[model samples]
Target: MLAKAIFLDIGGIVLEINWRKTVEALGVFDRSQQDQIWSVLGSAKIHLELERGNATPQEFFAFVRSELKLSPEAPLEEAWNQLILGPLPQVDQIFDRYAGRVPLYALSNTNRPHYDYFMKQFPVMKRFDRILTSFELGHRKPDSEIYMAAATEVGLSPSEIVFIDDSPANVDAAGRLGFRSFHSVNSVSATLEILQRHFSN
Candidate 1:
């Protein structure tokens, strides 16, 4: 079916990220502590609060410093943002091809700091018709509310919107909600391939 709108995930799909970069930047020298650092950084309980806007970046950074036992003056913000390396290769092609063809929305599960950093650093981000973020929406992906909210914002039914995300769980959630969902597996080429099959005339 032809899509009236498309919702795309930012990190991992439109942009490349490396969590280990953040961990190393934070000075976690022990290999044994890397997994622990990953768990702490990725912990849904801790990170989700930031994504949902329930916790301020300062609060989150303080918690990370305490949890990870980093120096009090650790460059937490810079280190945390190390996860966002840069945009995916050829991502602008997707926007170039589809910007005016159909509505393109960025649906991202992100916090305020990351949002601010990417917005300024990535010019491609300006290409989106709209950006729906977890921090702004108070909801994250794999949750039905955010998807429903996206549909409401665009005034489209789930079936009429094509959703693209790297996470299988998020794709499954969107699919369950009746969206025409595609798992792009963090590849711009894969995303372009999927969009061409559906969005190309």
Candidate 2:
């Protein structure tokens, strides 16, 4: 089937964010402690709160510290920002290659600061056919409405589009809505190759 649209997730897919690195950066720790930190880090409820501006980074750190019973003196904000590093390399090159060839959109659960940061750092985001942000959209992923909103914004059926996200839940949600989806564990090179193969013929 021809791809009528492409939806990319910002945080993990286009931006190379290593969330576990935040816990590791907190200095050497035993396996048990690491496990505790990892557990808090993977909680979607925490991320949803963070992305919605309902919880500050400091609050998040406190919550994690409380969960792990770690020192309250931990450098939470810095450590959290450490995980949210810069964008992936050659992201623009990939976007440039595919932008106008097909309708392209970005769907992310991000806050105002990060959204502003991205717009300033990468002007190419402005080039997308549409940008659906949870902070702005009031709808987040793993929710069919967000995917439907994206499809509606682009005037395409979900089945005609491909959604790329780091979260399997989000991919599965889109899949249920008739979208062709991929979990973005592989490199963008792999993703581009897949898209090229599908459209080249």
The number of the candidate with the highest lDDT is 1
Candidate 2 residues 30-91, lDDT tens each? 76876776776666476677765676656666676876567867766556655666667777
Candidate 1: where are CA atoms >4 Å away? 29-31
Q: Which ten residues in a row have the lowest lDDT in candidate 2?
A: 192-201
Q: What are the RMSDs of all candidates, in order? A: 1.3, 3.4
What is each predicted model's overall lDDT from 0 to 1? Answer: 0.88, 0.74
How do the residues 104-193 of candidate 1 rate in per-residue lDDT, one tens digit apiece?
999999999999999999999999999999988889998999999889988999999989998999999999999999898668888988
Which residue pairs in model 2 clash with each other?
none
TM-score of each: 0.95, 0.75
**CA error at residue 116 for candidate 1, angstroms:** 0.2
